[model samples]
Each structure stands twice: as C-alpha cells, then as structure tokens.
Target chain A: MKNSFVELHARERALSLLDAKTAREIVGPLDNMISPHLEPQNIVPESDDGIVLMRGMINGNNVLVVSIEGKFQGGGIGEVSGAKIVAALEKVLEENKQGNTIYPIIVLDTGGVRLQEANYGLLSISEIQNVVIALKKYVPVIGLVPGRVGSFGGMSITASILSYLIATNKARIALNGPEVIEQEAGVREFDSSDKDLIWDTLGTKQRSKTGLVDEVVDDTVDSIKDAIVNEIKTKKDAHRTENVDFYLSLLNKLDLSKKLDIDSYNKLYQSVVATKHEVPAATAGNKEGTKSRGRLWFEKLTGIENATSSISTVLHAQKDGKEYIAIVPDSDNKFPRVREGEVGLQEGFAVASIVNKIVADDKDKTVKRPIVLVVDVPSQAYGYQEELIGIHVALGSSAAAYAKARQAGHPVIDFIPGDAVSGGFLAHGLQSNRMIALDDDSITIQAMSKASAARITQRTIAELEEATKHVPAMAYDVDNYEKLGALYKLVKGIGSWEATDENVVKIKQLINEAITSLDGDTTLHFRYQTPIAKASGRKATLAVRKLVDEEWSK
Target chain B: MEKLHFNFDTKDAISKPVHVGVVASGDLEVIFRPTDKETEVNIVTGSDGFKEVWGNVLQRFFDRYPIQADIEINDFGSTPGVVNLRLTQALEELKDEK
Candidate 1:
C-alpha cells in the first residue's frame, strides 16, 4: 500500500507521527489569534502563525511535537510563530524539570528568520537557541529535517546543536541558504537554480557523511517514525568529550586548500582516524611548552616577560601601556576538541569571565581600557560535549560580555592574524566597536569552513574563488572582508605570521588609531554607514529597517 | 484584510462551544459558542476582495444549520469549500458535545 504520510502537510505530519488519537494541539487555529504584524504588511496571518504545537504521545511516550508550516511564508518565523515555538519548548523544559519526561520533537521546515519582522525574528531565534540548550539537559531534543523548505539561517545553527537530528533523504540543512549565499557571494559561488549543487552540498546524505546528521531515512512517515524511535531508545546524551579528539585530529588533517568532495573529505577523515591509532599517546599532551602564533603576538605586543597568565585559552596582557584581554587557542588544551583554537565550553566561559571582570573593575572609571581580541579561531568546537554543556550560552555569554564592555565606554578592537570563522568570529570579534586585521593572505574571515559551504551550496572551491572576486561576502581573504565595511581598518606591511618588531610597531600604531577613531563611540551602527555596506546592496536591509520604523511610529 | 459581522434568526440554540479546522494557507477555522438569542457570525480574512463571497458562504452555512450561536472565523485566504467544511465540522462537533 502506498503511504499517504509522505504528502502530508506540516500539521498532518505532526498528527500522523504521534500516536493515533493522542495529539491535542495547544494555541491552535480555533483560538482565532493571528500575527498582528502581518496585518500591517497587508499579509493575512494564520491563526497559529504557521506553527503547530501539539502535546501528544509518540510510541506511547509523552512528547511535544512542534511543526512548522512551510507553505505559509516559506515557514519563515515571525513574532507570533516564534513565540509559540519558544513557549512550547519552555513548557517542555518546565515539565521536564518537574521530573516529567517530556521529549521534544521539532519538525523543521523553516527558511529561518522572517525578514519582514527582522529584529523580532532575530531576537526570537536567539531566545530559542538559549532554551534549546537548556532543554537538552533534561532530554534529547530530536530534530526532524524533512524537505520542502529545509531549515536555514539561525535555524540551521539550532538544528546543528540538537541532541539527535534525523533528516529525510530530500532534506537540506545549512547555516546559509543557497539563494542568500548566491546573493551575497555571486552566482559563480552558488547558483540558485543549480538543484544538483544545492542538494549535494546540503542534502541529508552529504550532511550524514560530514557527521552533521545522525541518521538519514526515506521520506516516508514510517521511516521517520522508526528513526526517531530508534534514536529515543538507543541514543546517548550528547557530550563533546566523546568526539573532541576525533574532531581536533580531523580538522587538523583537512586540506582546505583543495576542492574537497564528499569522497575526498571522507578519505581525509579516515586517514586522520587511521593515523590517530598509530600516533604515540605522549604527543597528545605535548601542546605545553609550544607557543602558538597568538601567544607569540601577545608577548611581543605586551613587551612584558612572562606576562601571559595560566588561563586556559584566554591570554591577559598589557599592550602599549594598556591592559587588554586576548583569547587564543591553547593547542595543548585539556579539552581536546578546542585545543586547535576552536572555542568550546572552557574557552567561552573564560572569555566571558575575563571580559566581565574587566568591565566590573572599570565600572566606576570614565575611561575604560581598550580590550584587544587576538582572534584566530576556526569555528566553535563541534561535538556532542560542547552542545551538552550548552556551548551556545557559553559563546553567547562571551558575546554579551563584549557588548557590555563596549557599552561601558571601553574600546573593544579585534586584530585578526588567522582564521576567524563561524560562531567563533561572532562571539569574539563581531561585537567590537572597531576591528583591525593584517592584510595578509593567511587571514581569512567568513561563516563556517569552505568545505562545508561548498557542500551546502554544491559548488567547488574554484567556483567559490571566482565568486569571491565579485562578492566580498563570499571571499575569505582580508582584502575582500575589508570591502564588506565590517572592519574598521586593515594594516598592511606585516612581513610574516609571527609578530616581528616592525610588524608590532605597525599594529600598535593601527590599534591606537582605531582606539582614537572610536572616540568613545560604542554602537555598531557605524557598519551601516560604511560606503562598502551602502554600495554592496545593504540598501535592502536599511530600507526594511526604515519601513519597520515607520510602521512602528504609526 | 477585512472584518465582517452578521446576526441571523435561528430556531435551535447551541448547547456548548466547539471548534474546527486550521488556519493554514488557503484554509480557515470556525469556533461556535452557545447563544440563547440570534446566531451571530464574525469573520476576519486575509483576502481583501472576497467580502461578498464570504457573506454568501456564511449565509448559506447559517441557513443550513439554523442554530443560535456566536461564530468566529479567522481566515487566511480560505476558499468557499473550506469555509463550508469548517462550519459543518464545527456544528457537527457542537452537536456531538451536546
């Protein structure tokens, strides 16, 4: 018999997946409540705002299934729909805390944030991320990424951090949508019409190969049900420690210089795994006594002997007669996953604590010392333990602390000498008032790695390179990043990766210039005012903001 | 967006409140609450040009049921078929509840 569940809508999918006659929807359509914002935009709002929240039984176990209706606004999340999802998750968290084992199953068909609502969507996603991390402590949050409108944007980050992700063969999951990437990076980087490329990059099978997806099943409801059942029964609570060494070694072995297909990526993964078994155990702990480029720069910039403290990855220093905090990778870190400069739980908390402490110390003072971030992070450490310990909050806390520090009249500047990628960049440098980077080929900045991006967009490195020439957002080099108007200044004439005396002089001069230029200005509104941001099609964003403001005023 | 309200004379009174359908795209929901007097209907729809069609469909629904109740509908471009189906389902559910 042909299965009818494959063609079901999102609400139907939720009801079908639950135990027969057990699903009771809360805040459902009959409530006659709809989005207030949609009416202003001349859009008819759905009563439930495109989300179905049902308290039901799945395989006789109490569960909450939150399904997004992709047909409505491409399953974009606005205030009401976002609130429903958050409230449902919050309810689950509350029940779980009361010792009631309420499992959460999020059926993600969203295209991420709703651009019409803009800031509200952004805020809601952030709140959702915070709650998702909190919920994981009680039960494994299962994510079902079926096709139609596969999860993108902030939802992709949320999906990646889930305890167990089950995706259909047709499902596409990625941090950046192909169309957005194409718009930002150019057609050569990501052709929106290239179905094969999009699928190969973000399809369930590809994500499975990359270890981002836990299980890939057929599109049928039975298959999905069985996968979720199996996960609930057999999956262990996710912890980063389990996969730290593996990821660290795998990331170490990855050759980003070459165009990597799934086959090549898997080969590299296997080689790393094989070599891991052959390597001496002693070398794993030998990260001590070895100074990273960040540490070397910290020492040179500070010009103080033995100035570095014994903190995990956070380096405290005095530069140009001013105290600054620098978070760098501790290659010999006890947390193996973050040892290679990826921000993990410890690094996140450390950065937050150091910054928070600095803010607290200078609370009464009018002139807060400048905080310099020596950034070279590849990405947030991706593993089970990181998620288990709530890496989102850890990274979020650090970001919040920097924002706090900047608001408190401190000049926060980011000096990038290495890879500044993904959430690591967001947590460390993106919040700074002014950012300076060495104009070196070695310095790269973008969201996530190229291999992952190439997979998500189904393009080769050559295509990405070609697109980078036209689309500054697609480019990882500092020169292109400078074109985005995100960076305050880019210093040239740095001879090597190491901080030489002359290089330090140039950097310090630029740092002072950056600080002076800030003139106690803390808001990041300056980014929109940049000529590059205005010229490079940020007009749409500005226009939307203006429209939203106009609507709000009335 | 449009809002319409109508009150029609009916013979029977609904005993309790009942709800049906979903407010997905091209769909709607109806909630019926017990009323001792005239049957009242309230509609809020996304479609701007469908006031006359909505009136006709709702009038037909009240004609078929003839029940005294307060009816509320929140629609998102739902068609005549869906509107009738939801009204029928809501009335049927109300009868079952009684």
Candidate 2:
C-alpha cells in the first residue's frame, strides 16, 4: 500500500500523527451537533461540521489537533466548525495559563470562508486569528498544509501566521482561490483550467523557497510526525525583535522584482541571509527628500506643497480644508518589504492609529472631516517576520478603524491613483463610504497577482485574458472594477501616472461630488446596490443576509 | 435531509456510552448512550430519499442485538453496508465495555 499521508481522511491523518491509543476526539460526531446555517441553504450539515477536533499525545507531549475534512464542503469553515476550533484553542490557552502544557496542531485543508454563510465566516475567521495570536505566546501553533484542497483565503493568512508551518509538495497556499480569482480578475489573468501553472505559482516547493513555509516534508505519515516532533521539541519563538529599520535595510540590499520561482526566490533569500551580520546603517544619500507616488498624489489632491510625512509611510494632508491622512510607501522606507507602498505591519498599525485619532478628535463635532485615502498599495508585504508578528491583526485593525471612522460620520473616500491589491486594498479602500479610481491601466485592483491567479485557476494567461473580456470582475483594470459598483466614479484623461494640476483639480471635484452624494449616509451597503453586484450572484448573499437578520431579530 | 425515529423493545441495557465512525462523505456515525426506558434510535441523514432503506437497516440491526440504549446517528449519505458496519462496531465497543 502507498504510504502517502495525503490520501488519508481528516480523522485518519490526525490519528496517525498522534499516539493512536491515547487520542480522543472532542465534539466528535457523537455530539450530534451540526451547522444550523447550512440547512437553510439546503446544504448537508456534517456531524462534526467537517472539522475533527481531538486531544492527543504527540511524542509524549499533550497536543490538540484540529483537522479540516476537505471532502466536506471543500473544508469550508462555517459558524459551528469555526466555533469548535476556537473553543478548543481557547481551552488550550486556558489550560496553559494554569500551568498545563498542551500544544496546538492545525491540519489545514480549507479553501476558506464558507460562501454560503459569508458574514458569519468572516467574523469567525477574525475570532480564530485573535485566538491564534494569543495562543502563540505560550505554545508554538504548528500548521500542516497537506494537499487535495490545500489552503486559501483567510486560512492561508492563518497558516502563514503560525509559529511553524509544514507542508508536503502536494500542498498549495494562496490568499485567494483560483476560481474566485478567475471569476474576479478574468481568464486573461488566471486561466482556471491550467493545472501546471497553479502548482508552479502556489505549490509548497515555491512557498518553501520564499521562507514562508518553515519545513517541507514528504507525503508520508512518518515524515509529518517527525517534522512536528522536531518543531515542538526544538523550535523557539522566532519572533523578530529588531525594529522595522533592520528589515528595511535587509530588504533594500535584495531585488523584489524577480519572478517567484524557486531559483530566483532562493537567490534573494541567500542575499538577505548574507547581509544579516552587517551593522544597520542610516538610510541617507538615497533620495531622502523625494516624495513617493502616493505622497505626490496627496500633495496634488490636498494642495499641500510639503505635506508632513508622519509614521514614515503615512502622510498627513488637508482634505476639504481639514486634517486628512494618506498612507503611502516610502521608497527609502526602513521596512523593505512594504517600501513600494505595500501595507505591512507598520503601515497597517499606522493607518489604524491615524483613523482612530481622527475619530477621537471628531467625537463631539457635528461635522466630521472626510478621510481621503490615497490608495496606491500594491499588496500586503509577504515575509516570514511579518506573519510571525500577526499581520492579519494589523490589517484587520486598519479595516476596523475605517469602519469605525465611517460609523462616526466621517465620509471616508478612497482615491485609487495606483494599484490596490489583495489585503492591502481590503485594509485601506474597501471600507470607504465612496471609492474613486483613476480610469487608467495603472489603477489595477484584485485579490492577488495575475500570475498567481492564473496558477490557482489552472488557466493559461491567454485563457484568463479571454475570460476577462466577458467577465468584468476578472479584469484588473479600474474600468472593469467600476462595473462592479464598488467604485462611485472613475476619472478619465489622466495623461500621466503623475497626476497633473488639471487632473488633480478634476479628481478633487469628483471627491467633493462623491462626498456630496453620500449625503450623510455613511453605510457601505450602497456598493451592493450597483447594477453589476445585483446581477452578478450577489442576490443570493443579500437574500441569505436578510434571512439571517430576520432570524436574529426573533 | 431526513429525520427518523425508531424504538426496539429489549430487556438488556448498554453498560456505557459508545461512539463509532466518522461523518466523512458516504460515511455515518453511530453514538450509543445508555437509557433505562427503551432502545430508541434517532437518525438524521443527508439524503431525504433514503427513509425506507434506513428504517429497514435499523430494524434489522435492532432485531439482531436487542440492547436497550438511546442511539443517535448522523449520516452523510452512507450506504447500507457502511451503516451496518458502524452500528456493529458501536455494539462491539459497548459489549467490550461490560
């Protein structure tokens, strides 16, 4: 018989890894509890909600294993399953606080967030992330991503944040699923039928080279067991204690534009490792006075000749003649990974701080100053250190801050002059009451890179391109995104990437129009009212949400 | 989804509660808890169309082993053979518990 652990079911995998005789399942099928949400959607509720939680012994140490059943609903997490996992982790944390030792091992095989119960799934994931960060302080939260479904969406971020991650060659990890990316970004960017491309982009081998995955093991029970034992035995908390400046200097030495293959990634890795011993030098004589693309846009929009740059990446400007903050990447930024305007740990916290401050300042004021976000973030910075420090919390905090600001009556407007990709866009722009993007090729917005999209969707770039022609969501161009009703306006005739005085004036007029259109209505529900959203399968989500609300009220 | 309840008259009772099988696709779980009243079996299945087949299977198993216990089964489209196997396994565990 083949010794591949990948072929084993979720229960079998968990049982095989732990001491077989001592393993006992918590909230096992016998509990008779299933998801209440799935039934209304005519979806079958598995006895355990497709998540197997067990208390067991691994190499004589007490451990808790949370395994996802990929065969069940693509191992998508719903309320019950999410709660079960969270409860188990919380219990472990509580036990540890009382001087009991119990390690957490998560076997991830999820596509992330059960779309059937979207809002609940989102809330559950946030809770899961909070507990994961809290639990990491005591024990190393080990993540094992074996193949079949692999891990994507919110779970991908969850796995990335683990203290130790082990994956087999068959495993793939990504922020967004291939089909979802294809559905949103178009076939031209990510063909959903190309298998080789998907593996090439998100496969364990490539991810391991990037240093995101701590260990790559063979697809055998013994190999996985050994790796887990070794990690629990020897691995200390590898949290980076050096300031953001240390990472910035290290990032500055290497190139970030290389294709994400093993060889190219390894070269960059070697370069970063090679410079670790060198003393951190001051960031000087490297175009210190020059403003980034984001700051330039901020200057143009606010008419502030020299807007005071605060928190390095975050720039403070005047909007509607009031204090407005614009977060941009510093080209000479100390945090190298987030230099090109990617919202890293520092940027996320900075954005949150600014928004929270604005909210505090405008607490008693009848009229709130509009917070204009000059959106040019490419993506969240992808690095081991960033994950170790819980970038999700930082990113989630920024999103929450924007939501809070809007609820506080601040007309949050997102001006997309450049790319707003993935979690970066989610943190900065998605929470805005009204969003305006430059109708230019440079203004691309999507969950991830086109190459990653193509790989996940198993489609050739050509197929993805062809699909984009028919599907507006698939196209990354701001024009295509505008059709989705997420954007209130798209400014045309921008002659250059650098906004001219005329272009700036036009954009400012549009922002005023957007703010006026809001008419003190600060909710983000207006996005769903767009023709595209109403037509493109959002009706089901709306209906389900309505049902959920009606039920909740009862 | 189908919900069915069955009762089998018996004198003997299960010594302890026992759980067997996983709720994976095409699989089912049988959880047996000791009850003083009667041997009651409650079943909830993924497929609503298999009500008669489930009744027949449970009837046969209860007839074969007249153990007085409250049995609850959550099935995810399991075949008759799989259901029979899980019930037998749970019964065997119950027997071993004595």
Candidate 3:
C-alpha cells in the first residue's frame, strides 16, 4: 500500500516463497522475457517485476496468470509489458487450440498505455486486444480490477473485449478518467470534487448499472479468487459468429420512437435523474426514492402514468406474483438480500433473456417469443454480501446467456427506463441485439452536474464548454457516442412508458428486415457490424466482406 | 539491373491507402497499392540489407498462398498487415474471375 508496486511485488514474492515448486513453476520476467520496446526508451526494466506470466496448478488444473505490477509506472502497459501479455496470450491461445488445460487470468490495475512509450505501447494494446479475441476462442480471459489506478482507456477496452470482468468497490473503469473529461469538456459537464458523482459516473456501481462490468465484489485477494473459481466452474461454450440478422432484430426491438433525437438519447443514456427525493435513482433497498431522469424521460415519451411510485408499490407488485412492470423508485436499497439457493431474475437476466430469444429465433421463424429485460437495476447489486457471493459469476452467467441467445438466432431488444450509464447499460443495455433509451428531459451523464467532471480533469466548468466546441470527445452528450460509432440509433422524441408495445413491435419489424439482409457467411463483418446493432444491413455485409478478406489471408 | 515490371488487372479500385500495423523497428509498413492485379502481390524491398533473408521469408510465405496473382511490394519497411495486403493485391490482379 505504501508503494504501488510494493503489494504487487509482495504478491509475486509470496508465490516464490510458497514453495520451491512455486519458484520453479513461476516464470519470472527475470528470465529475459522483457518487451522489445523498453530498450529503445533506454529504461532499465525489471523482468520479473513488469509482467509475471505464471503457468501454475490451481487444484490440479493448469492456469496462466498475467499480472501487471502497479509499482511499474502505476501498472501502465508499455511495449515490454504489452509484448509479454501478447506472447502469453498467443501461447495460451495456441495451447487452448491444442486442447491444453490453461485458464488465462489478467490482473488489471493500469492507467492504460504509458505515454513515455506511446507508439509501441499503443500497438501492444491492440495486440493485446487481438490476443484477447484469440484466447476467448477457447478459454475465458478473466480481468481482475481492484486496488488503485484501476483500468482506463485502452485497458478499459481490453476489459470490454475480455470474456469476463471482475471488479471490487474500489475498482473504477472508464474510457477516460474524470480529469480528462473535465479538461476536455470543462467542469460544467462534470465535477470531480463530488465523491458521489465520481463513483456514480465511473465507479464500479455505475459501470455495473450500465452493464459494462460483469460483477462487483469486495476488495480482497480471496474474494477475487473465489469469483474466478466460480466463473471457471460455470463456464459455457463459446459463440463466435458473424450474423447480423440476430443483432439487427434485437436493435429493432430497442424502440427509439421516430420522435426521439440525439440529445434525448445522451441525456437518458449517460445521465442519472433522481425522483422528487434527493436519493440516487440506482442503489437497492429504499425503493421509494425519486425516479431516474431516464425513467422520467420514459414516462414523458410514453404518456404513461407511474402506477407504482413507492417501495410499497414494489412490495404490492411482488405480493401479487404477477409479471407486471413497475417503475422502480431509486434510493439506497440493499434490503432484498439475495435469498439463499435462489437466483431471481435481475436486470442481467432480463438482458440475457432478450439475447437468448434472438438467438433461438434465428434458427426458427415460427418462434415469436417476446424477450423482456426488466429495467429496474440500480446497477448490479454492490457491497460486501454481493462480493462474498461472487457477483461477477452471477453477472457473467447472465452475459453468457446473452451470448447463447445470439448463437441461437433471436432478436433481443432493450429499453432504458432510468439510469442507463456505465456497467449497467453495458451489461443489460449494450449486450442486447439492440438498445433504445427514453427521451427523458432531466437525464444527464454525470449523476449530479458538470461539477464532477471538473475533479478528474482539473478544469473549470467554463473550460469544458470551450473545449467541447472543438473536441467531440469532450462533449458530455450521449449523442456524441452515437456519432462516434458507439451507439447505433437515437430516437428523437417520445416518453418511455407510452410506446412499450409499439416499441416492441417496431423493434421486431426492424429485426426481421435485418435478418432478411444477411447472407450465410459468419465473418468479421458480422462480428463488427451485427453485434453492435447500430450498423445497417449493408454495413454488416461490407464489414463481413472486409473482415473475411483481412482475416482469411492472415 | 532489369526492372521486371509485373502488373495485373484488379476488379475493384484500391481506394486509398489507410495503413495500419508496423513491419519492425526499421521495417514493415502496410501499404495500399492500387493496382489492376485482380488479387496478386509483388514484393520488392531494398534487399540490400536482407536479400536472402527477404527472399526466404517471401518464398515461404508465397508457398502457402494461391498463385495467379500480380503484386509489386516496394518496401521501405512494412508490417505483416502490409505484407498480407500486397499479396492480396497480387491475388486480385492475377484474377480474371469474379
């Protein structure tokens, strides 16, 4: 803790000290396994300390550990670090293809690639991505995000590319940090000083809520180990395909009415709006808090009255044991202790259900099943108990279900009622075949205001405004993401609840059109254009052709 | 020095060059050669430093590749992506089929 790499080194040393077998078994970087890029920078790098690629036994099964040392430049990746990672990834991939029993685990706590060695570092990051794809072909690439520095930028994408992700409450993951946001957009869009805002925007809870993170856990070595063990135990078959029809169908179901526009999309998708009470829209327990800006937007778009507005409302709905959608009021609610021996249908289940429907429907046209994704997740349930139970496993189970749905060929769609930001959106919203958000008026990206963006970027509110005009990346609007090719479509103007049935029908229609467009080839194009739901049928075909040519020759 | 100019007709336009990846510290680059070689590749780098090495590398590479291609690879330094691209061009150039 005193030093960043101090704990990392100690962990490595512990491995060495565990037994002579440990030392012999652990292939420390001291064995000249350094990256080639380091020498050009003239930095004397430690071999064993940089990236520890250990091939060892975990309960009589072989596993590969790719641990980055936080002490080494905040555990930021560089050429050597990247090469080691890629090499390990390549080796593991090759081994997996050969039917070798090796589980690949990455200990992530990085600030992306080190600027000091930019080019090589960046390339390595890309290679790491390729390796992740390759490795995922045969085994899970478990990313461990705990402790300081966390994961950001290229590292965040790396996490995104992985088969599974595990995070602690202390862990934070974002494409760009708060300070960067502030610097780029100015403090008006985000304020770093607000602790709650910071956590809600980029923290594990926020990410879990948005569907970016697979699970959340407590900060401890043992907790992390348990999560991984659970993931391996419940691992499913991989689904690597290039089919646009399934994803297109899912996107069709994401009912962004013709009225909704980009601004509304950004507001509902990125921002969080608490109901009348000052309680956060997300977070379990209170259930009687204020509605999220997303929910309000949904209500506005749909012209539907909030029939249930209190925890008592949820209680009543549950009491009836009827499958009716109740607008979940957000407040601190940890009351619904995950019952022992019971895995209830949470938001993740909803997302996976949608995906499964699409996959299943792809094979059979007669199957017209409606896949419903309940939009009441206040982010994936966080805290000590969730960690103890291994939230990542639960979350991954949901993600795997979605993957299966894609394989089965059904169109899965989603609509964000409230608070569709970070991990929650990623898990429940993103993985779906298509995602649509309510045209919420009060929806904003930062939980509070621009004040949160200022903390991380060290810029005043005025500065972000000035910068945003030029730097599209700095713009806090959700519409920018769509422009940047992150989101597929943004509905112009419509309340959330009013268009529920219409949205469902429209989505199904769109999906049907998409399925008709796809040919029989499952190539790279399908992977790129089909999965995201935004790319059109033509684009998907182009992507498939491009990737096929590129990958086939390679 | 005999400049053996090899050319092929391409079915599609080679758009413009949008290069990615690296050859080596001083080597590879992915070059977009707009050619008529339906899909053929011709590789010619300054073999001054690595003539035999380059030939060995390309020879082994071409063996796995389907022939009936025309590709001209003028190498300053390129990466694997570029190499693959040049070969692809050769294949396209040599192609008379749809």
- What DockQ values do the models have? 0.27, 0.26, 0.02
RMSD over all Cα atoms, model 1: 12.6
Higher-scoring candidate on lDDT, 1 or 3: 1
List of chain A TM-scores, every candidate: 0.56, 0.57, 0.44
Query: On residues A95-152, what C-alpha lDDT tens digit does candidate 1 reach at each position?
Result: 8898988889999888776644433354355446656666777899898888767777
What TM-score, over all chains together, does every model reach? 0.59, 0.60, 0.40
lDDT of candidates 1 onward, in order: 0.67, 0.70, 0.45
Collision pairs in model 1: A201-A455, A239-A384, A239-A385, A240-A384, A240-A385
Tell how far residue B22 is off in model 1, in angstroms: 4.0
User: Which candidate gets the maximum TM-score versus the true structure?
Assistant: 2
lDDT of 3 by residue, A278-306 (tens): 11122234322345433433333333345
lDDT winner: 2
**Candidate no. 3 TM-score:** 0.40
lDDT per residue as tens, model 3, B8-88:
333555443322222222333223444444655444343334544555555555556534333334443445555556555
lDDT for residue A66 in candidate 1, whole number 0-100:
90
* Stretches > 4 Å off in candidate 1: A20-22, A30-33, A237-262, A269-554, B4-7, B15-19, B35-38, B95-98
